[model samples]
Target: MKWFEGSVADAISSAQQKRCLFIVFAADEQPASVSTQESWDSDAVGSVASSSVALKVTPGSDSYTQFTQIYPVTIVPTSYMISPLSGGPLEVVQGTASTDELLAKLQSAQEKLTSAGSAMAANTAGAAPAQASAAATAPAPQTASGAAASTTPAAQQPSNEDKIAKARELIAMKRQQRQEEEKQKDLDSELSRRESGKKLQEYKAQQKSREASDRRKEMQREKDEADRAREEIRRKIAEDKAARRQKQSGSAAASASSEPVSATAAAAAAPSVARPPSLPSDMARIQFRFPDGSSLTEDFSSTTQLSVARQFVADRVSDRFPNGFSLCTTYPRQELTFEVDDQTLQELQLSPRSAVLVLPKTTGKQRRGGSGAGAATALSPDSGVWKIIMIPLLLLQAIWQWLTGSAASSSSPSTPAPSGSQAASQPMPQASSSGDAAEARQRRGRGPETGSSFGVSKEGRVNRFKPNDGGDEDDDMGTWNGNSTQQQ
Candidate 1:
C-alpha cells in the first residue's frame, strides 16, 4: 500500500483510522554518491510504512513539530512509535534495522497486545463464574432489622441452670465469640489495607499521567518559540537577499548611464566578419513594437546597454510617448529586470531574430509614510464614492422642497368672492359654502379689519364699508350696510 504523505496531524488521523501506531522521524543524511532512497523506497523497508503511517519531519518545518517535541530525537534516523489510542509514544526504535528484524519487532508488539487482551478477557470470564457460584452457595446475610431480637425479663436471667455450671458455660461461649470477632476484625483490616493500596496506585497513575501531559505542553511551548526564532531568521535572510539585489541593480544602472556610446553601439555597427571567430559574434537587429502596432527597428551591438536601447526606442516614439517606456519580450512576455540594464546585449542573450515590445512606463508614485491612503489613489470625483457622497445632499434637497411646499399651501389665502354688488347696496343671495364663510371668520381673529385686504364673516360682518353704499365708516371697522345704517 502507498503510504499517505502529509503533516504529523494527518499521520495521526491515518494511524487512528487504521488502528496502528504512527511512526514519525527524519531520515539520516545520505552520502552525496548514494544511488538509492533506501529508507522509504527500498523493498526491504517498504513494509514498515505499509503497516503504520510514516511522517517525515524537517527540523524547522511545521510538519511533525509535536512529534519532535514529545520524543527527544538527539540522533538522526530515529523513529518514534506512537500509540493511536492514547496518542502517546509506545516505543522508540533507534538506528537502522534489517527488513526481517523490523517486521519481527512489529509482529512482536502486535502479538503482545493481542495476548494481553485475551488474558484479561479470560481472567474476567473466569472471575464472573466464581463470583456467581459463591453468591449462590452463600447463605443470605441477616441484617440488624431482619434478625429476631428478644429482651430478658426484668433485665435478669439468673436461674436457667445451676448458677456455677451456667456461669462456666457462659464464660466459655463468650471467649469463643470474642475470638471469632477478632478474626472478623483482622479480615476487615486486611481488606481496608488492600483497598487503600489500590487507591494509592490509582492516584500515582493519575499523577504520572498529569505530569506527562504537563511535560508535553512544555515541550510544545519550547518548540513554538524555536519555530518563531527560525521564522525570524528566514525573514532576515530574505530581506538581506532583496537588499543585495537592489544594490546590484542600482550600481549597474549608474555605470551604464555614465557610458557615452555604450558597447552595444560598437557591437551593432562593427561588421561581423571583422570579429574573432571564437567570440560567436553576430549582428542582432531588434524591433520594438508599440501598442498601436507601429514598430521601430534599432541595430545595436549585441553587447548594448539596456539604457542605450531604452533611449533609442524612446527617441523613435518620443512625440507620442514622452514619458519614457519599458521594453519586454513577447511570447510568454516578461518585463526585463533593471539588473540586466547594465549588462551587455550578449549577456541578455536575445536570439538574433527576437523582437522586444515597448511598454509604457508604470505610473506609480512612492508614498511617504506607507499608509493605505498614500499607497492607494483617492477615487475620482465621478466614481462610485461620489455617488454615495451625494445621497445626503439629495435627501436634504428633497426635504427642503417638501418644507417649502407645505409652507406655501398653509400660507395661501382662501377668501370668498364678493356676491353681486355688495358694493351697491343689495345683500346678495345668501353666499356660497358655509365652510368658506367659517374659514374667513377664523382668519379675522388674527388681524385687524382693513379696506384693501378684507373679508365677510359668518355674522355678515364686513371688514370694510363702501362710503356711498348706505353705510357709515367707523375708524378701522365696518357699519351695517343693508337697511338701517343710512336712516340712522
Candidate 2:
C-alpha cells in the first residue's frame, strides 16, 4: 500500500506566521513533477519541492505503527488564497484549526475502529480485534485534511467574520492609493494652465504692436495726400496769374495794329508812354485823400506819384478793416476835390477818379514851378490834339481809298511811285531846314526832342537814349514860345 506524506522537519517559519515547506509528496499526489522553484518575492513567501518518491505502508512499515504519521494535525489561518484555474484570489478557511492532542487521540481512535476490517488481510485477520481495542483507547493524528473534513459540515463550520474583516481592510488601502494619484493629476493640470496663460499674454502684446504700426502707416499716407493737394492748388494759382498777364499783352498788341496805316502804308503805331517825368523839387511833395473820408497830407518831396498814393491807401484801409474794405477796384471810388476848410475836408469822402490839382503851394518869381498849360500842350503826337486830328485824317483816307479802289492798286510795294504827288506832300526846303536844326541841336548835347526817341535797342535788352541835338539858345527860345502860346 502507499500514502502521500509530508513533515515539519524542513519547514521554515516566516515573519507573517506562515510555514514554507519543502514538499516531500506533492508530486506523487498529482502524478507530475512539482516545481522546485523557491519564489522569494519582497514579501518572502517562497515555495520549494523535491523529486517525486513513493510512500510505503506494509505490516511493519513506519507509516502503519506510528498513529501520528498518516494523520498528523496542523493549524491554518483565515485568509484568501490564489486559485490556479480561476487566476484570482479565493476565500480561505478563516478560523484557526488548532489541534488538541487529547481531542486528536479520541478522533483518530474512532477512525481506526471504523477502517480496521478493511485493513486486515486473511493472514492478519486475527489482529482485527486487537486493532479495534487499541483504536478505542488511543486517539488518531489530526492533520489538515482530517480537520477540514470535520469542520466544513454545517454543524461544525468555521465563521466567516474574520474573512470579511480582512477584505474591508484591503479595500480601504486601495482607496487611499487612488486619492494620491488623483492629487498628482490635479497638480499637472494646474501647471499646464499657467503656461497657457503666459503664452496668451505675449500674443496679445504682439497684436497691439501690429495695430500701432498700422496706424503709423495710415497717418503717413494722409500726410502725403495733404502735401499733394497743397502743391496742386499752388500750381493752379501760378497758372491763373500767367494767363492774366498774357491776355493783357494780347489786347495791347491788337490796339496798336488797328491804328491808321500810313500813306506809304507803313505801320503807324502808338508810341509807348515816356519814362516817369523828372519834375522840379517843389512838385515832388504831393498829398492825396483816401476813399474813407480820411486825408493823408504828407511831403512827397522824395516820393513817386504811385508810391505816395499807395502808402496813403494802405494806411487808411488798414484802419477800416475791422469794418471791412473792398478790393475789387485797384483804387477806391470816393473822390477828393481841392480847397476846403479843415472841418469840411475832414468830413469829405473822396472818389476813385479824384484829381490832385497840382498847383504851386508857394508862389514867387524865383519859386520853382512848371507851366501847366504849356506842359499839357507839349503832349506827344500820340495824345491830345495831334491824336484827334490824325484819327480823322486816317478815317477819311481809308474811305477815299475804298471808294476809288486805289488802295489795292497803289498800296502794293511794287507799284510805280507818283512823282509829283509825293514831292508836293514833302517839300525839300522844309526838310533840309529841319535837318540843319537837328544837327545844331546834336552839337549842343540836348536831350531827346520826342517821347518816341526813348526805347530799348533790341528785344530783352536794356533801355537806351540818344542825346538831343538842339542848342541851349534854341531850347530857351522854344520854351519862351511855348509859355507865350499858353498865355494866348
- The true-versus-predicted C-alpha distance at residue 409 of model 1, in Å, is 99
Error of 2 at 293 (Å): 5.6
Best by lDDT: 1
TM-scores of the candidates are 0.23, 0.26
Residue ranges of candidate 2 with Cα displaced over 4 Å = 1-164, 252-488
How accurate locally is residue 144 in candidate 1, as Cα lDDT from 0 to 100? Answer: 48
Query: What TM-score should be assigned to candidate 2?
Result: 0.26
Predicted candidate 2 versus true structure: per-residue lDDT over 1-488, tens digit per residue: 12235322212112013311111111112111212111111112211112112232223344334522422212111222221111122222222222232124323433443243245344255555655575556555479755654443433322466545654565455345545655776788788888899989999999999999999999999999999999999999999999987987897788578875674334223333422345454343334434545544443333233433444555655654444322222245432322231222112322222234222123433333456645655654434565544554555544543433232223212222223324223322222354554453333222223443331121122122322343243222222121123211
Query: What lDDT does the true structure give each of the candidates?
Result: 0.59, 0.37
